[model samples]
Target: MSGIVIVGAGECGVRAAFALREHGYKGSVALLSEEMHLPYERPPLSKQCLPAHKPIRPKADYQQAGIELCLRTRIEALDLAGHRLLGRDGSSRIYDKLLLATGARARLFPGMEGAATLRTFDDACRIFERLRAGARLAIIGGGFIGLELAAAARAMDVQVTVIEAASRLMARGVPAEIAAIVEARHRAEGVDLRLGMQVAALVAGGVEIADGSTVAADIVVAGTGATPNTELAEKAGLAVGNGIMVDSRFRTSAPDVFAAGDCCSMPYRGDWLRLESWRVAQEQGAHAAAAMLGAVGEWTTVPWFWSDQYDLGLQVAGWAAAEAKTTIRHLSDDAAVAFQHDDEGRLICAAGVGRGNRVAKDIRLAEMLILREARPPADQLADPTFNLKSLLKAA
Candidate 1:
């Protein structure tokens, strides 16, 4: 075998290389990255990597893992029919098996230039340079990425106001009540949130809303969300709905070619859907690696994600249909839970804020609910009597 060729050197891409070696695959691993810098951790690209990171050992170890890396190269065209790839610099590459982890790119505001987004290492560096001590930043969107930027800006003592087109903060993912709590925390930290406000335009020094009020700032950061990189797959004529379609084993339309990370769409709950969560990126990458190595496992995984904003930590596990019945629970008067139902009245999703460990337990419940392995009643699931895992094992 000629080894595995991995694309996009981010979290999923790096993990796939490590996973291939960890699973006892004896073959060369090649990674293609367009970034000039070596493959780096992204979570901190928002948190600490800009200024620097606390524990820098992981960054060093990741490179020493025996994976060959090609930096600053672009794979312009993927010839699936011929089972070969063409690069931007006119080089040909072939693989025994391949993984497309091309990842996601930031959605830009069409008319805006000189704007900033926190998607890649370069974006983070640029954003950091503009973050002078007293600079005012206007961030668009109120999702996890946007809120994380708010926390980072607030940490640097910069003035920031987040503009969300949605009615509430993180309304699409978090439960309404939890969203409200997150909103309060951010506001208390002096972050001005313009909810239910659509951005009409991004200017040189401010944001003009659809309502015609202009919010001034020294810099503008847009976190409107991500659009998965699907052009290469689409051009190759793969079954593309929201993303490159894949099966439970992370196998793509072409049997020998697979896709994972943010560019992949797989079965969830039942039908095919695309997810951009961190867990999805990780599990799919590992599963795709296994599938490529001829040792595949069931890839149906409990989707989990967490967001840190101000002093609150929100964790969600499992998929919650937008129309599912939702219940709100309060751990303290300040901390709350938003639980969702999916017609069977089973818990489809749970979002919580203000307590990380508390939310961790409920997340476990949400996972069991998805697997239909939780034997306790719904009341017990919501009970604040004890730790979630303890309760599950106790009862």
Candidate 2:
């Protein structure tokens, strides 16, 4: 049948299907997934949903929306000329328009039999079950995933040890000053933090460091980042970089075929940037669907991501310039917000951490200032007495 065929029924696929309907497209939508479960969220895989699984949308909901759920279906290859997708089981289907949202996969350590990586519901369940009381959990790659899993493990009374190759936690995502706060918080909660270390081998007990130290872990988990699933796109002869390259309108190199989510890199700041974030995936999916419907729209939302570890919550809005000047505003002993400004003192990004709603107001204000490209004096930004909301009046 000739209709819209969406491969990989994750957040991007599901959102794109609904977005098509929203954009007034009355056509058949087929959502295909290699996994058997319904479309779901991935961020919760390392957090609360690990203990209790939650479906993204009910089966009945999909039916009501006229979205055909093709479970356990794998598209082995694509025939661009014929608009046919060859399946692994020898099944074939034609599409009027195709949306590739294959997403990404965990970058695993080769020959590591005991270590596990969290990317799907099944992976999360297995990790949760293995995190028993007094169990030694060793996590490699001190990124957000590793640190978040460490928090979850510690909550279950498991002895947590985080081994990061970098000098600080979440080196790529957070600033050095913010990294120190995260390290301090995790350490205070009894997490064994190993920084500036490399895993030479994964033994039975745990991973062996290059420095000849072995971390004793009954269960070893690696959060060593992910790689985009762009093989199918590449086989179809689409231009691929870090991900499938798309224009500001989310169109791939081929005609009648588009890409989105983690698998596709959209235009950002004069270059192509792929964001593996839930929020970005959803937005791009919707925007891509809209573009497929002949709507003129660009994916230009400010990148936002957050992490909740223990009682502290960290939220970041906008992109952080590498050489930006940073200023800190402390609200209390357990709460503070950091702002990064460009050379011209324009607000580029802001990060905040606190127990509850202490940072909420600042986070909202920062997001607004970033969108407005507001430039405030470094002295005013660092002064706790200076009202951040006052900028809105002149904004």
Candidate 3:
């Protein structure tokens, strides 16, 4: 049976089914996910949903998809050479094509017996139980996940301390200058930020620091990094880098087999970037489905990502050139925009915080600029005389 099988129920797997049907791919589709519950959104697990004791999923979203869901089942192994998969029940099924959308898991608080993570539904429940007011919370990483949790814990009147091995917050995502703003804001909220502090060991009691200072806490969390669930493909001898390598078409090393979302590293232009963002997952899932449906297309959408924290909504669009002499404009006390250009003086990235619709406008423009022309820096672009609508059209 020329059926398609998806090995996960996460955004990538579910969205691929939706996109396939929406684009007129009617082959048999089945999704195998280990989680017994419906696919829930993970973005808010660290913020709104976790603190409110709410499920991150909305029921209405998936009820109409009519996608076959196999819950409470884990994939035991993948026999790529035979074009089949072995499930937890020792059952095997042959497939004409397959997609692996296995997402990442939480970076655990290593060696801590009672250490908790906020990745899955179970993790959320486990972590929330320890969020009582006056309870001490020790976070091992100061990235977005850790900082967002810090914000939530602070709002709940809990004592939160984030130990970052790096000097800046979200060092991987945000520029150093941008990270400084967040650091200052977190300090104002009374979040204990041990910058440049390394956690030497995780014990049943608490974390042991390199400086010999022990951080005692009821809950210990790690937001250090997420390792992608790519064991099946790797064991099958598929090429793997930071993730399973795939072309713009989303096909991996094995023909009749594909990968998407965070599990797949895809090429964009000349760059081989692996984005772990939700938007990327949705877009790539659709592309993979399209390819299965005999649609020839490249996944070359401008990258867009957003993060919502306490009174701060950060949105990034396109790629920011680090060395590009750029301009910045403070749109308001709580809002700002930056225009990044290349050495040849062409705009490459349009980034903003708060009032980020400007970046969105550029994205929606039909004739996208290749950034070969010189435009005024951010300050001039923010001037009242500069009509955003015209620039949006020009873009």
Candidate that would win on lDDT:
2
lDDT minimum window of 10 residues, candidate 1:
48-57
Per-residue CA lDDT of candidate 3, range 118-160, in tens?
7877777778777888989999899878888888889888888
**Tens digits of per-residue lDDT for model 2, 4-64:** 9999888888899989887878889999999988778777778762455567788898888
State residue 329's C-alpha deviation in candidate 1, in Å: 2.8
Please give each candidate's TM-score: 0.92, 0.95, 0.88
lDDT of each: 0.78, 0.85, 0.74
Note the residue pairs that clash in candidate 2.
Answer: none
For candidate 1, the per-residue lDDT at 112 reads 49
Q: Rank the candidates by lDDT, best first.
A: 2, 1, 3
Model 3 lDDT on a 0 to 1 scale? 0.74
Q: Over 4 Å off in model 3, which ranges?
A: 49-66, 108-114, 320-326, 355-385, 392-395
Q: Candidate 3, clashing residue pairs?
A: none
Q: Which scores greater on TM-score, model 1 or model 3?
A: 1
| TM-score head-to-head 2 vs 3, winner | 2
Residue 314 CA error for candidate 1 (Å)?
1.3
Backbone clashes in candidate 2 total 0
Q: What's the residue-level lDDT of 372 in candidate 1? A: 61
